[model samples]
Target chain A: AQTVTQSQPEMSVQEAETVTLSCTYDTSESNYYLFWYKQPPSRQMILVIRQEAYKQQNATENRFSVNFQKAAKSFSLKISDSQLGDTAMYFCAFMNIGGSQGNLIFGKGTKLSVKP
Target chain B: EPEVTQTPSHQVTQMGQEVILRCVPISNHLYFYWYRQILGQKVEFLVSFYNNEISEKSEIFDDQFSVERPDGSNFTLKIRSTKLEDSAMYFCASIPPGLAGEQFFGPGTRLTVL
Candidate 1:
């Protein structure tokens, strides 16, 4: 069994500033993947970024990045130059590398609000 | 770009009634999944279907729940007897072959059981 935890229930950031959302997981499997998803008011879950356990190098999108600490079982998402559009519910998810089914286990999610 | 789509954006049904949620996965996807999220809770995986059969399912997916791909393009999740606890947003997701862990999600269907 795998579990993902997002300790922060809510977060706020000023426009153009940076914010980091925390995430932790419990898993016995060594090869796996971590992901950050954003659900805006429209209720669409959008993929933000992804990180592989074997790859020490972090994954970075245009304005989204992750700090993946394999030993610590922590994968946090950092949003740079935050915009109002970034305000959404952010979730951390985990999945095994290879298997017949690749269902994602998601965290409780952190609600983020970006203010001007 | 191709994306997963779910029909009946919102559904309200009485307890003990049956409801079927439909999904159109990405055209080239080989694996399909169903997940649900209660209000203010984490998303929980319900079941995964592949090769026209169920590959895996979670404890939350009981006999009351079933999935099928009756046609080549449409995937469906059926709840035989809806309970009040079944009120949640049901999401459909899909993954292209060889995409490892990248699963694209649909906009979710909000199910309200009264």
Candidate 2:
């Protein structure tokens, strides 16, 4: 069984600054996918960024990026030039590349607040 | 952008009553899933469906819970006997066939069992 852990319960960043949210997972599977999802007050879950375990390079999308360290079993999300709209509950997820569809294991989540 | 749609954004039912939540996945998606998140808790995977059959399920998806695709357009989750612990936000998600597909999620239905 794979378990994702988000050690930071809450994080705050000033507008236009940068912040990093930490996440770690325990998985024996060599081939897997990691992801970060955002949920606003609307309760809609949105994909922020994803990283393939085999890919040594980190994944970056707009202002969102991930620091994926396969050896350490760590995948952290970094939001650069943060804005108020980025405030939300962020969750880290993991999925096996070998198994069935859409079976993602998620972390408890980190509530991020972008203060102006 | 294509998305998954869940009906009855909110559902309120008494304990021991039956409740059904509906979802519509992307038109071309091949995989469907159901997940739940209790208030202030982690999102937990319940079940996954593909090819009109259950592909995977979690311990949380006990005999009390059932999933069905009665028609081409609608997928449903039924709780035979609701409990107070079942109060949570249920999200429907889908993923298209491919190696690197991302699961798109619906807005979620807030189920309140009193």
Candidate 3:
């Protein structure tokens, strides 16, 4: 079974600054997917960024990016030029691309507060 | 943008009562799933359905829980008898064929069992 771990319980970043949320996972599958999802007060799960285990290059979308170290089993999310809208509970997730159905395995989540 | 939508944004039910949660996945999506998150807990996958059949299910999806796609557009999850432990935010998600890993998630339905 794959398990995602987000060591940081809470994080704060000043507006316009950068913040990195740490995440690690334990999975034996060679080819898999790592993701970072954001949940605001609305409780809607929003996709922030995703990284394919096979892809050596990290994935970046707008201000969100991931630092994926397959050997270390680490996948961390970085939010550059952070804004107030970034305040939310961020969850790290793992999925097996080879399985019958790739169900998501999520971490406890890191509550982020973007202070103005 | 196309997205998954769930009905009854919030539901309140008494213990032992039955409640059905509904979801309308993207029109072109071929895979559907149900997940739940207890207060202050990580989201957990309950079941996944594809081609009108269950592709996978977690141990948490006991006989008391059922899923259906009677209508092509609506996918539903029904709890035979609600329990206090069933109170949580239920989320529906979908992924189009060929997009195996990237899934679109619904806003989620908050189920409160008392």
Candidate 4:
């Protein structure tokens, strides 16, 4: 079984300030994928970034990046130059690469607020 | 870019009434999924459909819940009898044949059961 844990339930950062959301997971599988998804007030789930366990390098997408520590099973997201639009719930998810059923196991999520 | 779409952005139904949530995945995507999120809760997987059959489902998907791909494009999830707990945002996602975990999500349909 796999489980994703988001330690921070809520966080706030001022506009233009950077913030990091923590995430950790428990999985025995060697080959897997980790992801950061953003759900805005509209409640639409949007992919922020993804990291593969096989890759030692982290993943970065524009202002969103992930620090994926494979050995520690930690995949955290860092938001740089945060804007008001970045205020949303961030969820960490996991998926095994070998499975035919591509189901995502998501964490409880951290609600982020960007103050102007 | 191709995207997934869902209908009935919001639906309100009484208890014991049936409700069907519809989704249209990307045109060429073969795998489909349904996930739900209660208020202030994490998103939970409900079921996954592949090749016109259910490939995987969570324990939360009970006998009262059923899914079908009646047409080639539209995937539907039907709840036989709505419960107050069923009031949540239902998200539809789809993945192409070779994609790993990069599933495209729809805007979601908010189902409210009273």
Quality of candidate 1 docking, DockQ? 0.81
The sequence of per-residue lDDT tens digits that candidate 1 reaches over residues B1-114 is: 888999999999999999999999999899999999998888999999999999999999999999999999999999998999999999999998975778999999999999
TM-score, first chain, each model: 0.97, 0.97, 0.98, 0.98
Give lDDT tens digits, candidate 3, residues B22-54. 999999999999999999999999999999989
Query: Which number leads on DockQ?
Result: 3
True contacts kept of each: 0.87, 0.77, 0.79, 0.82
Residue pairs in clash, model 2? none
lDDT of 1 by residue, A1-116 (tens): 88999999999999999999999999999888999999998888999998989999999999999999999999999999999999999999999866547889999999999999
Q: Whole-model Cα lDDT per candidate?
A: 0.94, 0.93, 0.94, 0.94
Each candidate's TM vs. the true structure? 0.98, 0.98, 0.98, 0.98
lDDT of 3 by residue, A1-116 (tens): 88999999999999999999999999889978899999999999998888989899999999998899999999999999999999999999998987558889999999999999
**Model 3 alpha-carbon drift over 4 Å, by segment:** none
Q: Name model 4 segments beyond 4 Å from true.
A: none
lDDT of 4 at B27: 91
State in Å the error of residue B21, model 2: 0.3
Total clashing residue pairs per candidate? 0, 0, 0, 0
Query: Candidate 3, residue B4: CA error in Å?
Result: 0.9
Task: Give the range where candidate 1 chain B is weakest over 10 consecutive residues by summed lDDT.
Answer: B94-103
Compute DockQ for each candidate against the true complex.
0.81, 0.77, 0.82, 0.81
Stretches of candidate 1 above 4 Å error? none
